[model samples]
Target chain A: MSLCEAEKTFILHGVEENFRIDGREREDYRPMEVEIGIISHAFGSARLRLANTDVLVAVKIEVDTPYPEKPSQGKLDFFVDCSANATPDFEGRGGEDLATGISNSLSDAYRSSKAFDLKKLCIMKGQKCWKLLVDILLLECGGNLYDAVSLAVKAALWNTRVPGVKSVGIDGKNVELNVSERLNDCVPLDVSGAPVMVTVCKIGEYCVVDPSAAEEKCSSAALVVAVSQGNITTVLQGSAGSLHPTTLMDSLGLGVEVANQLNIALMETLQSAPPHFDVGFLK
Target chain B: MSRKELLSKIGLRADGRRAQELRRIRCKLGVFTEPDGSAYIEQGLTKVLAAVYGPHQVRGGRSKAQYDAAIVNCQFSMAVFSTGERKRRPRGDRKSTEMSIHLKQALMATIKTELYPWSQIDVYVEVLHADGGVYAACVNASTLALIDAGIPLKEYVCACTASLANNDIPMVDISYQEEVLGGPTLTVAALPMSEKIVLMEMTQRFHLDHLPKVLKEALRGCKDIKVILDEAVRNHLVNVGSSSGWVKNK
Candidate 1:
């Protein structure tokens, strides 16, 4: 996918004209399609397709002892698996570096209590708590992975239902918990404060949101901003290029605005969809 | 044996399927645009996606390229959440490595490797759901992906699993529940047109006397699967051809 100098110049000119190569404005995002509750085995699941980049997320819940320092709060772990079906380059251990990068950024974004409250997942202080394992599978790489992964993760978390505990008995350093037998008796997490990541790619003199694969190659650097409730939760700089302070500030502002809009649209879509609706890969 | 009965007294299996019956198979070709060719198939609850990437120059280094025949490389992976219990890792385990080698063996037997000298064809299969017959599903899906890539093959390579039910009756296309119910399962990959067995693997060995009937049932299942896959390929070709105005003849 190496682009010649002429192709780079053409893309630069398009960005300067406020129209991207894909006929999108600087802050315009590619049309995204989201489906939830697709994986029947998982506690929660979501599949998001942002143009050609497809991401599948599934959340599984387990009961484990809470960390000593965070006894009152539960644990949330993110794991990313890059499937070879996405590309031959991801075969075997080739995609490990990229997978780790994405998972690390996600954990950083969700670490803040303001972004996602982990206390609700706690079942008992220091003894037992729920652990949410969010597994993300990358099926395609159109570009802008951070944004797509974050949105898909948020949707999966929204779909997660923690089994309700009817009773918790503790005696002599032993804890016994009774989970409800009814399948529908569960608690859904409050994801209103979950962060939505927006990648602001700097191409030429303009900043672009949701850069296509081609545009991404032309960009000197990019900023990944995770926004929760209109506040920046985590900011990550990617690529080997540097950004001026003013440009960084501008991209940050743009990232927050776009992220806010994306969050609203995502929530609306998740709420409007019918329960138990599944549009798997068959479509 | 404390195992539950795999076949009831009425000749119906646990899933209500009769002996020699295959699970419903649905597949689609060219499911992804990035790969040279891609296909997705679902055999009952087992879902697999396969992608073919080469026939170009070998990757990594030129030293690994074979001068006589093109290398057929295969990788088999399962999603962590594909099973009833979440897998700790997607791949790199001993079981996956064995499955990868077995998959390559099956595909290599059908592909015409000598046609493209010093090149390589990489086939990757990812299991999204693993109800049973994961290896068989991978082989079937890879065959379709190779066909979609326009790779030359001697014939359609189909795989199936068979088990002895009620000590004499043979059942085809064993599911995960049946596999766990304690039965000797035999898996066979074959080229149905030529009736050549590419690979045969068995788990929990049964009496050698019972092998012939089980193997026959598996081969029959493979032949039936070949018919379904062949029809699917033709239908897919028609749809792709028609959509691009390929109907107009010179």
Candidate 2:
């Protein structure tokens, strides 16, 4: 999707005027739709579509020994898969670099205890604990991938339910856990503190949130800010272009402001969402 | 471990489906705008999404381009969380590579590649859930995607899986549980309109005498699937056409 020089200048002028190509203001976001518990086989799952960008997230839990260094804490791992269906460029191993970058940023954002507590996922100290594997699939890329993926991940984690442990038996060197068989005997995850990322793109002296693919191309640099409970968790600088110190700080501020608003809106939608239905891609 | 019956006394399968009945198939076309054509299909518990791109100039290098016919490229992938157990990788495994090759073969049989010389067509299928018959689901989903892409094809290509329930009774559309159980499964991809078999694969050896019956059942399943896909395509066209006012006169 290479842009011509004149086309780039057109986008630049639009940003300067604070009116985007899609007739949106600099701070406004595109329409988004979120669906939870769409994947029945997964412990938790979510699908989010921010304009044309689509992300699907699923969380699977397994019982495993805790990390030796973090014996008292459970584990949370993030894996991102770039499906070729999203674009032919992502075929074979072409998407690995992008997938790894997204997953790494997600892990970094969730590393802080204030963002997402790991102790709550612990089952029995160092012997056995629950491990949550968050798998994210990229079905479409309309730009603003960081923000879309993070929101989907948070929604999926919010929908996750950990099966209750009936009892734990320990004998010298062996530990056995009896998981409850009842479907409703489960503990839902607390995702109030989950971080939500916002990508603030610096386009022609102005900054914007949720840039469209074309807007993303016009931007020189971008800042990804992951906000959790009104606090910044992780900040990443993307693209090869350099940002001035003042501009970087300004973009950071904008990112946090938008992220907070997004978090509130996400919570409202999740809480008001009805029970699971079969409205996935069919809709 | 005690063996469970694949079919009940009254000829019902483990999932309460009759031997000839297929799992519920719900599908939608043009699910995404990024690709030239995209589709999502759910065959019972198994779900698959497919997207088709091009009939355009060959990518990567021109040396790979064919002067006589377009190169048909296919990639088969499964979401890491698609299976009961989490998968470590989505694609690039031996099984996925084999599936990709098989998909390409099936699609090539139906697609009119000679119409676009020195070009390429990319078909990608992603399995969101793998209850059973993943390969068949992929083929079915890809066919819809190609059609949505407006690619030229001789006829619709449909795939199905069949197995011998009790060494005598043949069953169509085997589920994951039945596949896990001991049984010989046969997969067939065919053009139902022309009654041409594009590809056939079998797992676990069965009596050669029973091959004809199993193959017949699998082909029948393919024909049935074709009907369903045809109906879906017509419904999609009618909706799209009327919405654009192109079919208003009719």
Top candidate (lDDT): 2
B1-250, model 2: which lDDT tens digit per residue? 2367788888888888999999999899999998998889999999999999998899998999988999999999999998998899999999999999999999999999999999999999999999999999999999999999999999999999999987889999999999999788999999999999999999998899999999999999999999999999999999999988989665
lDDT of 2 by residue, A1-283 (tens): 7899999999999989988889999999999999999999999999999999999999999998999999889999999999999889999999999999999999999999999999988888888999999999999999999999999999999999999999999989899899999999999998999999999998988999999998899999989999999999999998879999999888889898899999999999999999778899999
lDDT of 1 by residue, A216-266 (tens): 999999999999999999999988799999999999999999999999999
Q: Lowest-scoring 10 consecutive residues by lDDT in candidate 2 chain A?
A: A120-129
Could you tell me which residue pairs clash in candidate 2?
Answer: none
Clashing pairs in 1: none
Largest TM-score belongs to which candidate?
Answer: 2
Location of the lowest summed lDDT over 10 successive residues in candidate 2 chain B: B1-10
Error of 1 at B12 (Å): 1.7
Error of 1 at B241 (Å): 1.5
